[model samples]
Target: MRIIDAHQHFWDLEANYLPWLTDKPVNFRYGDYDAIKKSYLPADYRQDAQEFELAASVFIETEWDPTDPLGEVAWVNSLRKRESLPSVMVAQAWLDRDDAESVLAAHGQTDFVRGIRHKPKAASAPGDVVPGAPGSMGDPAFRRGFSMLAANGLSFDLQTPWWHLPEAADLAEAYPNTQIIINHTGLPADRSDDGLAGWRAALMRAAECPNISIKISGLGQKGKPWESAENRPIIRDTIEIFGADRCMFASNFPVDSLVGTFSTIFNGFRDAVEDFTPGEQQALFHDNAARIYRIDPTREV
Candidate 1:
């Protein structure tokens, strides 16, 4: 089947500063990382996805240096020229920063840019890597940055943990005109039954807002079991909650490479959703992403 990977990334180690991917002493959600620390480019992705018919992919921001956020978009735009697979680009902007509107405007100038992702994971308890104070999304400056998205004709990608979905829902409710996509199937980091229950409940809450959609990717976090059998339940549940129209599958690429290969992650999604109708399968793998990202699905890869 032809598939459009809804979320993935490419990074040049020499050209960009990706401290999180390389910096030692990092407490990544998944424990050890030495496996996939090298540069991951489009060619590498093509090789990893060799077993499947990869129609297109969406290149998401890699959270590069905040000072020159547009640099990441420019660099990825160059890649998009050389490789047609990443037909869409979702750049980053520090929404809390004062100069966010200017940066967003610059990003808007790039034709491939469809949305912006500012990491909003709040630090609620101790030992959280990216903890934010309570109600950080409600801050005046942050909301101000968010308000500018509609004017720029861009969408928003929210990446907070499952617990923060309700807060994200608040923002979605406030700005119905803005399309908010929840990344990583709500990032269900905790695979335990109790943890999964929390994730499910929060996902339902976030889905209540019709404008909010969910990206069912990035399920291969650290320490999680890496197999289709393990992912089947949650994958099915996610599709059930958001329904086929609102849910799309993504590879999450190099980040998920640590858990399994591209074929493995994507094939697992296929297996999980095999019972759905052919149109539903099309929606999960390609149609939904094309519509949401405004990409011409017929574009040559």
Candidate 2:
């Protein structure tokens, strides 16, 4: 089947400055990531995804140097001009920062940039959530920058844990025109019964917002291999909550390679939804991402 990977990344550690990869190792959610610190350009990604028919992909910001947000976009533009893959991109924009307006304007003018990703401040646990904290989603300044996205014709890529979904729902409601794409199924790392229950409830709240969509990637667990039996319920629940039209599949490659091979993750997704109609499956694997990310599958990327 044809595919449009909704979320993936490419980085050149030597050519660029990615603090998390290049600097001293910080604690990572997916365990040790030293295995993938090397450059993963278009060629590396193509080799990993060769088993699948990948029509295009959405390049997400890889936490590049915060001081130079536009620098990442410029590099990706150059990469796109040369490689012609990652059909479009979601650039970085720190919403609460002072330079948000100028940075967003620069990204808006870029032809290949489709959206922006700024992971809002999240509490360590659900109970610790402090609403309207300085950099939290409810912060007035952050919302001020967020409001500017609609004018730029750019969507927002949100990557917070499920506990913060209520805030996400409110943000979506406040700015109905700006599309909010939830990354990693709300980072559902806790798989216990209570954990899943909380996750499902939070997802339900976010799903009520018509402007919100979700990418079913980054579901890998630390130290565990990707398995359909373990992930099928989460996959099925997400489709049921958001419906196939609002959901898309993504590899979260290189990062997720810590848990499984490209085929392991993509094929696991296919198997999990085997019971759905071909159209629904097609939407999950390809159509929804193309629509949400504004990627033209027919374009020669």
Candidate that scores best on lDDT: 2
TM-score of each model, in listed order: 0.94, 0.98
Tens digit per residue, CA lDDT, model 2, 155-271: 999999999999999999999999999999998999999999999999999999999999999988888888889999999999999999999999998899989999999999999
Tens-digit lDDT track for model 1 on 1-301? 8888889988888778877766665557667766667788988999998888888888889878777888888788788778775798889898888789799898788788999998774755324533235336767678888999999989998887888888788899999999999999988878888889888999999889999999988887667656998788989999889999999999888888878888888889999988899999999998898899888756638
Distance from true location, Cα of 26 in model 1, Å = 3.6
Give each model's whole-structure lDDT. Answer: 0.84, 0.92
Deviation (Å) of 4 in candidate 2: 0.4
Candidate 1: regions farther than 4 A off: 124-135, 298-300
